[model samples]
Target: MSGEFNLIEKYFVDQQAQRSDVVLAAGDDCALVSAPVGSLIAISTDTLVAGTHFLASANPRWVAHKALASNISDLAAMGATPAWVSFALTMPEIDEIWLAPFCEGFFALADQYGLQLIGGDTTKGPLSLTLTVQGLVPQGEALLRSGAQVGDGIYVTGLLGDSQAGLDVILDKSNATKPFASELEKRHYLSTPRTQVGEALRGIASAAIDISDGVISDLGHILKRSGVGAQVEVEQLPLSQPLLEFVGSSPQAQQYALTSGEEYELCFTVPDSREDAMWQALQDIDCQITRIGTINDDDKLRLTLDGQDLAWQLSGYDHFKTN
Candidate 1:
């Protein structure tokens, strides 16, 4: 360990640093946590680099917000209520002008979810941010990808591919300011983690996952983990009004919508018998839940469009792909 400001010492290492359920924290040697007797812990981490995750020139405040929201989405998948988070920021230099607004955006969402920032580290390096978030659920009640079963109905929250549509606009900059383009851009920047929706889904969803690496790929995680297959109806895949207007009904746009990354909507599976109640519950909260597909016992993932089977051109976004 280098002697330069120890992260544990400056930020984590002391009883005075305790924020919530962190019974013991950094400084000594180990961190201790306490959970309510009937509660389970849900933890997740996400990292965003300047050039990799967002444009190098992206606003610092939005960057901070996305970094936290992405990790919070994981907790949502587990149907957990967020509790705390620790941030690790590595930047080339310290700029108060940037950090101030960044912290404001970060804390604003954290406060909204009642999450406490317990500890974190700041270092000199390229612009990168990582957040480790924790949440709580009733013991043995956390949702899991492995819980999905055949014959389950597939559902997705909100729309898909709006973020990808916004990204395309930013990259090409071809179109003049259009209403759809503006909405897509805003959705790409200000995605809300479905914490309330997730919590409401507890005991209802058989399996769940957040769409981070596009719908096709993220859904594959659920199918693979649950040892089940799924057949999605391309026509039923929910596309935001902005996305439909921006991309139109072109084949290429449909491919991108199916494979583009950074869509943070929740995809879940529920039994048909429970569909009515589930939809009612989510609708009560004003969340638009769309049925896009159904689970299958066959070991093949398939897609259908307008009552006809169609081969998907792409399996979904992969970070390693040259495309």
Candidate 2:
């Protein structure tokens, strides 16, 4: 095999990987994907650089997982059912020691969602991973940020600020206990996108977004698109047992709860009328969900912690700002 083809075939492609909709797989010049009639395709692309997204020495397996999961989170936000993906890897050089575990992580996560890796590219350059994910949502039924109403309740699946707490552990291992630190590290490296919750929330959630950035900032997307505002009760934001232990009850923890990002939980809005149905649907799923705020008539987004006003400042990761 040619050098490029050898690398791709060895680490990425699974010739035995089965998908009826995939007319052509990785060896082709272009991949041909088919969707069921009447279903809409949802496509999302994400790129993670070595130093920016992960430490250069970080586990290649985790690096692969994060790249794909982040894009999958985007599809989940739109209530799309994941189907296929195309990967592009740019690396300083070929090293099977890194490549082997990387593909292992990629395929493991793909199997969980029944996602197919149909095609991708491999090139020598700065170390980076880019994944393009595609999913199918029924026609006219995909959830959107513009669907939120003024009285809708703002709800989030899973805990918040764990990823940032994880980043803390990454930056300073001495800051936390070994076990607790491991928990935080796991959150930083592996974020489980709420794919099932998003799919289940269709027609139930008024608006939906994934908590990649801080909730306050991400909710702003829903507010801007839905042309409405929200009032968040900061004290009500959920934190995991590990996260609570990591920072304790303090302003610092509070800030982490409100501002840290990359949790990948689904932040959704549900109308009062659908509240019962939402509860009923969620009961069958094995996850945590919480209502932290409510939509409003005012155009301003505000927050209250322990019934006192909390200032809104310091948004989540902005590529331009971070740069």
Candidate 3:
């Protein structure tokens, strides 16, 4: 097996997606990246374990893709433009075959966002990946969870619950034969971070967060931070065609839409004054946006279906909670 430095040099160094703001990149003690004048640096890191995050038999390419994309999603939620990333990879053994496709997946998404790989480390361990992504946003203009105000419309970008349904398919938890098996699997492994949508929402959205821990859990973040409450219309939750086909409009689908994690869609609030401007700003964004609820003064979250209260017993994914 190749040594750590040799593997790093071979797989990660001198890769594509170089940025002019990066003063120094990989192969250094530490990376040096510059933030443009009047801009603030946004940083977020995520760790993905082999069994807990992805199946042990999962493809290395998709694993790398998910690891990096999830972290970038955090930056997007802050309405930042992704600029650079540093990742640490731990493996049971240095298998060049696995390392080969992993870099392919990592750099493929990096190139898409023009992200420069600044620095990272390689170690031998229980097969895990951690990526730290950095982005730039205008000072005093970064969207935040605490900015939501009472009466602001709660909105979400793209279809929700697909990632959870895809996980069910991956784990063989789905009872019925799934016709859109590949589509669901793709949604699970290839969740797209709403970077462009986040950029469009910079000035329009009062508060924003990426839906990694399901809608209820993530939106709860905004509510808690803003010291406000929200009432989400269950009927207004967006369901993709594959998810609708998989489970129809039943409560099961609704539950998934409410509590499924790793969706990576942007859930944001728009002040009533900017509601029209918000629509116009996001009209040309690739993903669709839905107004599913409104902020309130009560400081609690409520759910309703067709103007009637809907009871939900399930909670979002929790890493330390014992069943």
Candidate 4:
């Protein structure tokens, strides 16, 4: 091992969790993986930067957890089975204390989903983590943003706004005083990718997206791609009691659900006829699935509360925007 590779193998590779799909793991020119027969590989990459993705001084373990979860969530969105991951981890300093816990967090999530750690780079730089996750889906069966249609039922897994509520606690210590504050913070930091539920959704959901960028914004991707519109019932949005206590009002709860980002829940569409199948698909997963809306003919997004159109005009999270 080169000096850098030595550092990586010691701190990362030797500690990695294993998988059945990886033919080759770390300490190689390239890692090889086997896609299951009759399955196509799905790949996605995600990056988390300090001060943006997490607080600069956030716990290293949670940072690592969120990084891996972000990529894992993408696989879930596509109805794929996660198999392997290659990490590109950059750090400003080599703190074994921090790296050890980070590795623990990374492997915890990996082991849960049977994700293998392949080969990747390690370097000294700003604190950042990028993971490329590979998953498998039966050929021609991946859920997509363009599959939604008029009369499709709109749904999301898990409650919305928790991550944003978590962010509120992180950004402002005062929020930590709220009820269930630690729970909210943990929700943002410890991502739970709905891998099983997503795989089960194949052939049942016409369109799907992981809610990384908030419901309206990410679901809008489905609307635009499928050439359809959506009408959401604000009163029907699934909000956790903790989130309700954290945000403190219907309006605030609605704003968080509609605009805040990085919750990693799946938002999907099913043809009206598949609603029962949708329920059957999720029976095995331990998640709260809620139908919030229906796909419509026109390309105009609208939300209604108490049978009246809500004139809310907030766009969801924009990565490169300044106001």
Q: How do all models score by TM-score?
A: 0.88, 0.94, 0.95, 0.95
Task: Assess the local accuracy of residue 318 in candidate 4 as a C-alpha lDDT between 0 and 100.
Answer: 53
**Tens-place lDDT digits, model 3, residues 98-159:** 88888999999999987888888888789888888999999988999999999999999888
Please report, as a residue range, the 10-residue window in candidate 2 with the lowest summed lDDT: 314-323
Ranking by TM-score: 4, 3, 2, 1
| Model 2 per-residue lDDT tens digits across residues 243-267 | 7778876566667877777778889
Per residue, candidate 4 scores C-alpha lDDT tens digits across 1-323 of: 12243565676675554566777786668888777789999999988887778766778889888999989999999999988888887787778888888888888888888887887888888988789999999998899999998999999988898888888788778989998999999998887898888899999999999999889999889999999999999888989899888888978888898876888999999997888988887987899999899999977878999779999888767532321
Question: Clashing pairs in model 1?
Answer: 13-26, 13-27
The true-versus-predicted C-alpha distance at residue 143 of model 3, in Å, is 0.8
Worst 10 residues of 1 by lDDT: 8-17
lDDT of each: 0.78, 0.83, 0.86, 0.85
Q: Name the regions of candidate 1 deviating beyond 4 angstroms.
A: 1-33, 175-179, 250-253, 318-323
Flag regions of model 4 displaced more than 4 Å: 1-5, 318-323
Return the lDDT, model 2, position 235.
Answer: 83
- What is the C-alpha lDDT profile of model 1 across 15-119, one tens digit per residue? 233456876544333446678889998999899887777766767678777888888999998999998787788877766777767777887788778777766
When 2 and 4 are scored with TM-score, the better candidate is: 4
lDDT of 1 at 10: 33
Pairwise lDDT winner, candidates 2 and 3: 3
